[model samples]
Target: MLNSFDQKKQKILQEIQSDDLDLSPKGTIDELCIPIINLINSNDDMVTTSSCSGRVSVYLEGTKSNRAVVSKGNHGRWLFVTHEPHDLKDWTSKINFVYTSSFPDPNARLILYKFEPLILHVKCRNLETANKLYQVAMNNGFRESGIGSNFNVAIRISIKLDIPIGYKSPKDEEFEEDILNLFVTKDYIKYIDQLSLERFEENSKKLNQLYKAIEKDLSNGTVLTIKTNKPNWESKEERRRRMVKEGLKRQEELRELKQDQIQ
Candidate 1:
């Protein structure tokens, strides 16, 4: 099992080094969470598969008549995305352009949504290592962290948070209102965006500190203990269903392996 894990880790690391690194909308590994990614990859027991540092986006919802179909299409077309704080004027200008473009469809709305809390997926050497990483992540405020495995990859750790940052739609009046209302305005949106960015920064710092603490505990030959609130994000039934699905996948893989060996 250990040998299998090592081989898989080597293959994944090679893929990462060979230009298969993250270059998506979520940004690259270095841009997302370099320090933590570096620290985890440095260990022989782990390698990050995917991650996102979180983002604030201006999304344009599709037409109301075709809402169901368009929701299935591209519900949130990203007009803009930022990992850091943005200028209010820039956002306002962009919003105005989108609002004007969708003139015929009054129901067509431009929404600003902020996805707070970073997400990181790490493949560990074994179930034990995955559990350790999950615990450490939970300690660092990633209450949504969990452990899972498949036949090919025996251990996977996910680090995340359940904080709902931005989903509220700004009032339509705010666009035409001469006087800015506290509820909806370009400045208000900027303020909220800035707050979410600050929270992301704070949580990122905590993650770094947690990594350092884990390192210290390992050096001292002591088990790390963390005190944190119970996670209520996912229900037990949901988790059980997911685990059962993974188990079925693993069984199929093993059957395939056996057939290949016999042939």
Candidate 2:
């Protein structure tokens, strides 16, 4: 029998590789471009090979592309993708996984790397946890960028995960719904603190799982880089003052132009 970690990896690889783009909606079709872009960003070159593993499903939002991607493995299911913001790169990073979720869900696998441009490889066990995690991460401050409207991404690399069955969380359902209350704004630092607190208070058991997985990575010297949001210092007043100065300079030049015109 495959070890727990090996099993999870296999599960993730199979799901992503088997996704049907045609059956997928326009928004999902767009997400496929994400890995291609990420591969480029990571190496400034397209990846010759990329794949996804696990049984993953996506649901779209009515406006823009509001969708959540979920994954299922022998172990359990959790939210994988919350909101499919056009820029899919926003949803990826690398981490350690004993069973992926820091718990056992292969879909919530956190793939980590060393000395690579920071990227988080996210594969959640279900859409609910995926959505909740995204909201919480964004509420803690994260941003997505890249790709014009024409090119949307749906599928990307897949990895397999093998986890023992019957590890799903019942609380995650309620947590997913409450995720809407989270947001990434100027007060993001506060939100991050609140989220960390809530995470400990609400889901200490699962948090311990994630902690163990991450602990292994740290011990092995696998660097983890998470993106953080900071407030922009320039305010409307500062911007306006700079603009006004430029406008005054233009007016002076206009006056000189009239003098030259008359002469």
Candidate maximizing TM-score: 1
Candidate 2 stretches greater than 4 Å from native? 19-24, 27-33, 36-140, 143-263
Residue by residue across 203-254, what tens digits does model 1's lDDT show? 6676577668557542234322211111336575664454345544554555
Best by lDDT: 1
Span of ten consecutive residues with least summed lDDT in model 1:
222-231
Each model's TM-score, in the order given?
Answer: 0.58, 0.18
Residue range 1-263, candidate 2, lDDT tens digits: 97553455455434433422222112121222333223222221111122221122211111112222332222211222222222223222221111222343343322111110112334333454344434433332223312222121122111222222112222246544211111123243233333333432333233233334333421234332211111236564664454345444544555465445423
**Candidate 1, pairs of clashing residues:** none
